[model samples]
Target: MTSAQISPRTTAEPTSLTTRSLAPDLARGAMLLLIALANIPWYLWGAEQRDLSQHPVDGSTLDRAVQTVMLIAVDARSYPMFAALFGYGIWQLYSRQAAAGTPHREARALLRRRHWWMVAFGGVHALLLWAGDIVGAYGLVGLVLVALFIDRADRTLRTWAIVLTSVLLAAGVLALISAALLAAAGADLGASGQVGVDTGVAEPSYLASVLDRVVTWAVGAPAQAFLTGTIPTAVLVGILAARHRLLEEPERHLPLLRRTAVVGIAVGWLGGAVTAAQHLDLWGIPAALDWGFLFLQTSTGLLGGLGYVALFGLLAARLRRRERGPGRVAWALQAVGKRSLTSYLAQSVLMAPLLAAWGFGLGAELSSATAALVAVGVWLLTVGLACWLESAGRRGPAERALRRLAYRR
Candidate 1:
């Protein structure tokens, strides 16, 4: 169908607050906390050596403990969850358009427009504030996936998801075998690369930091979206789950949700624990095996992310059965989730200026435990801001801007 065939009146408006589902928003709200935890470690710039998890190799007892927990639960896990939610939201937009009688081509066009704007938003975000911006990666992923598979059959989606997941798993196994062989051959595994570098965070000059962040983001964003099997795999699975309305109608799929939560989390945590042990030197693993451990952590992270989704679905189901509505804490989290883009970007605004060397340079002083506290504080402040916006019946500034751009009359 041609674009002219679909009237502007037939375009689906964004989902109103009342019509929104709880599970997805709740998952996103909670996921932001994980995102904060995962990101804050990078700002610990004074560490001489960081492990594959981007955590410092040496710390006090409490710091090590915090790192251990974060490695096992937060690292590599949060992004996949967000990616799955992003994919789910993409389907939601397309399905809403179809319901509004938007032609397939027009619906696709609307999505592309939004995704392109997201890429632009991400680019600006990286250039100005944070190097580890994920918005562009997700936007790029959405563009490709929507173009290629939005109209594909359910079976086709499932087939591709499986194929991609298997490929990731095979690569992980190969890395493990290769690591073992190299170690046996007396290779120096300690020479393997660290997971992250102190490029932008450690640069004392603001202009230099901006250059570093942009260059890192330019290289990292596309690589993250396409090269990392974790994201695409989770996104495809999310698309499949959205087809079944898994999160929207969790009560109908309690058994499936339960099994997924149990099994996925178990496998995910196990993989992370092994990596954490290696990182802490508890396993006495050779440095050469670091790559293998990283592969294992990343591959299982998709499962962990899906598991978190299922857990939130269950939580929503429980909330639905309650006589009273969700409590204030839950309400606040939902508020933040509703304006997630703003909250996410606000995190960078609050953090980079306070922690980076170009700003207050607090990152050089904070330990793992303290850094985690700072991350939580930043998230809480965003929550407060979101709640205020919620009370005023206003959208986040970022959300409003994107909506204005993407849904132009």
Candidate 2:
């Protein structure tokens, strides 16, 4: 098996900063914003209250509206973007190390260093503040993927693409068949089943509980990120995108991207709608709703994730053509992308003071609307701060630290 080696490149370019890739930076930044917005409502609720079987947001009309919009448009979309970008970053890292003529063993060491850096950062992020640690998950899954895919990149990517496509198709077909059978028997989806919370009353201080839960998730999230959500889908698709040079030189594949985007939009919307309808509380638990949720995730993951990638890729290509001048928003987003880890951690750190029950105790009080509004403000503040840092510094603190670690002393 070929070990994953870092890509080598001339350091003269130093920043590799360019306006061409601005769209992805902007889109990624926007995705983070949406993720934060969507999560605030969840944050307000204690983890103990997050039972999927029960309606988490079932109070006011506004709550339902937010839940509907997030599930339909945002939930499955944001993390995939984050995961795809992570894969892209990996490819770039490997490419640069390879170019530098770093020996294969040394290069592989560098990749491991980078992964470790992410793990360390993730630990801090989870323990100090936020519980939702993507980097922890990314580091773990990335180690596995890098080991499995490095030697035969082409083969690995192809196998993943085929496997994911098969899984998605199988799930979708099974869902439709189940729905038809239920309809024949005159089933309903809106019915309820017995569900309850069983929190063993340890009842620690709010901060202590948050920290404990975050620690547990930080340790285990990598496997779940790969096996459970859209991370696998994103990783497979990211490999495809990188191999095709979709991010670096997408102009070469603009036509294919455009066509895929079109198809993706149609299929994603239609399949998602059908999947959503299956959850009308008709047949109860372990029936239409449960099975339908699984298929819905697959279909939406395939269609919406790919659609967003293509759309953004096309936009990036267009921006490249229009002139290489950096727009303010684009520049700010690029800063966030450049030091993504710092910005990501910064959000979680900022969240602690805002969400901890020991603080405002808003951890379980705010309405969805209030949470969203506050999240947007935080995102704006982050963007502005990132832009300012980029103007004065070469890279975000986290980015510089990781690079130094990867290169080693």
Candidate 3:
């Protein structure tokens, strides 16, 4: 191939590992840590009560305190960051695929394969371990993103961003109108449909629930996919961020990042407050009795997600300004981010033995506070393990496998 035919750059700044942000690495590491941390209380609560009603699990005053902090800090931000990162990765991957002149059909096939694998992984996770699986949802949405970008070779990623933003704004308006109409009609609204109460253990077998979930996704996922619009939005944002080298050369982007942060916080708070109000139980079975719970989820997840992007970007800018040393902690976090899948799955599998009824059965036994502490311990351990693996090799096992499958090597 002619030198001029070389693929367009995909990654932010230099398209090399050395130039990439320690921020995305550190941010992703922090995200995985929070994911594990967030799961513990939720797990313990599930053990104590079969249904997921309120988010803040009831416990001792100490547990209550910890739960409150988590609700304010981690819960408000983590998953949104995670989802945004997912979008960023999609941008990086899809752009690279495009630069290669890979046919749209071929690229789409790869995303489909990846999605199916993730669905399988989610199935196993739900059946054997827990039911709150995001991987499947992420994968399902990711597939749509792949399709959207595949044939858009002539368009810049910035254009995609505008399109995504417009769509989100439109969806938000539509959802708000729907909620208002339902409220005016005195219609009882819950997260899903008018359904059974959440009792936790008596809810149903994991298998049955997963089967139902799979079927639901088959039918309803398209609607849900259209509703959230996160995947496409994320891809657009990520591409713009990458093209501008925002994630890499922080000095150049600090001014824009700061502005985004300020705006995001203002908008996010307004959105979060409205969404949070829809929940009858901030700490109880919120999905069941609350009117407009789904509406809240749609709104909050988007608003909070935007806030997280700004927050992380701002934090990264600050971190970059410090000219910090490459310490063990940094190394550990970078390692974990590089191979997040292994750590994520490891947490899911490891948690089964730690809290499941079939194992130590410490689910309900541990308070939310203790669960949070345990989550910290687990995060630290995972960090150490990731560091060790990175020292020994380039990729974590899962990362390697995914790459091999993705490239069909």
Cα RMSD for candidates in order: 1.8, 4.6, 5.9
How far out, in Å, is residue 50 in model 2? 6.4
Candidate closer to the true structure by lDDT (higher is better), 1 or 2: 1
Where model 1 places Cα greater than 4 Å from the true spot, the runs are: 1-9, 189-199
Off by over 4 Å in 2: 1-20, 46-55, 153-156, 172-207, 218-220, 271-288, 323-326
Model 2 lowest lDDT segment of ten:
194-203
What RMSD does model 2 have? 4.6
lDDT of 3 at 323: 60
80-120, model 3: which lDDT tens digit per residue?
56777776666566556657675545555666666667766
Question: Which pairs of residues collide in model 1?
Answer: 189-288
Model 2 per-residue lDDT tens digits across residues 194-310? 333211112236556665656566545764466554676677667667766787777898888898788776666665555444433433333434554655555565667677777
Question: Sorted on lDDT, highest at the top, how do the candidates line up?
Answer: 1, 2, 3
TM-score of 1: 0.96
Model 3, which residues run further than 4 Å from truth?
1-20, 45-57, 97-112, 151-232, 269-289, 318-326
